[model samples]
Target chain A: MEINHTVIDSVPILAVSGRIDATTSRDLENALNGLIEEDNNRIIVDLAGVEYISSVGLRVMLAALKKVRPKQGDLMLASLQPFVREVFEITGFTKLFLICPDQREAISKMKTG
Target chain B: MMGINREITVPARLGEIPAISDFIYEVMSACGFDAKKIMEMQLAAEEACTNISNYAYEERNGQIHITAAAEDDLHLTLEDWGTPFDPTSRIAPVTESPAEERPIGGLGIYLIKNCVDEIHYQHRDGKNILKLVKNKD
Candidate 1:
């Protein structure tokens, strides 16, 4: 998977592309953990480019959420493709995280709070 | 419609998951499964195969044999010579729980159950065989 890191209005945005399965979730886990370790708690993950995600990928996101929530920060998701979104929905993860239609909305929400 | 059958063997290791997924993708696509169904089957196959790779063999190296056949439905059978365990025997995780309160371990099998139409497990001749089926009709 390809992960591009950027800052949108000071919120760290990770745009992930490619399939996220057991083989590639570690890369995502490390990147998210690295961001959390650096004290960047409020984060947004852009899944518009991601075509697939398995439970391993979900586990990484869950772990990241657990870490960031304690610091008064949250990991928001935006632009999920249909298949990826279904996984979250089936797993009931849609209710667990803040999901927005785009990065602009996510950034706006983050700035408002 | 004509039937198709194919099989592959990969080392029971995390690194082989992508290859296994690729194989599933190719066969499922050849079976005329739509993009959405293809992705669902891929996820289900990966979860099952990854579990075998991670827990079936323990510390010793082993092989996972995956067979795919498509007729009226798509069938995937995974066989391994490692420990005998039934993935379907576990209860599905509670999806209604809040994220923080939810545990992490059971999601794999949950995905497998949710994505596919049918699943069966058998231990024969000391080999654990897992069968997953998705109907096209």
Candidate 2:
């Protein structure tokens, strides 16, 4: 997996590509942890390029969410492909995170909070 | 039985998951599963294989052998010589639980159960065999 980091209105946006499974989830966890440790609490993950995710991937996201929420920060997800989106839906994660149709919307939501 | 059959064995390690997934995707695609069904089958197979890679071999090195066949439905069997475990026996997580109360583990098997049409587990000859079947129609 590859993650490209950028800042949108001070919120870190991670544009992730490739698959996120048991083997690749650590890369994502490390990226997100680095951002969290840097005090970049508000974050956005762009999944437009991600083709697959398993429970391991979901665990990383959930851990990040738990870490950030306490600080009044948020981790948002955007541009989820149909299959990826379905994983979230089936796991009931759609109710937990602010998932947007695109980066602009996700960033907009982050800005409001 | 369908005429198509393919089998592969890979080291029971996390790094090998993609290769396993690719194999499943190729076979399932040839079996006439659409993109969505293919993705679901891939996810289910990956979950089962990941469990084997993580827990089956303990600290010792081991390998997982997978066989896939298709007729009216797609069938995948994962065999490993790891510790005996039944994934079907694990209870499903509470999907309605709040995120804070949710547990990290257990979602893998839950996903496998939900994505595939049927799953069967057996242990014989010191091998843990997991079979997953999904309808192509």
Q: Which 10 consecutive residues of model 2 chain B have the lowest summed lDDT? A: B98-107
lDDT of 1 by residue, A47-85 (tens): 999999998898899899989999899999999999999
TM-scores of all predicted structures: 0.95, 0.93
lDDT by residue for model 1 (B20-135), tens: 88898888888888888888888988888777866677736999999999987899999999988788776466656664453333677888888999999999999999999999
Query: Which residue pairs in candidate 1 have backbone atoms (N, alpha carbon, C) closer than 3 angstroms, thus clashing?
Result: none
C-alpha RMSD between model 2 and the true structure: 2.0
**Candidate 1: which docking quality band?**
medium
lDDT (Cα, tens digit) per residue for candidate 2, span B1-137: 45589999998887888898889888887777888888898899888877786667764689999998887898899999999978888746665776345333367787888899999999999999999999988
Residue B19 accuracy (lDDT) in model 1: 89
lDDT of 2 by residue, A28-94 (tens): 9999999999998899999999988998899899999999999999999999998999899888889
lDDT of 1: 0.87
True contacts kept of each: 0.78, 0.66
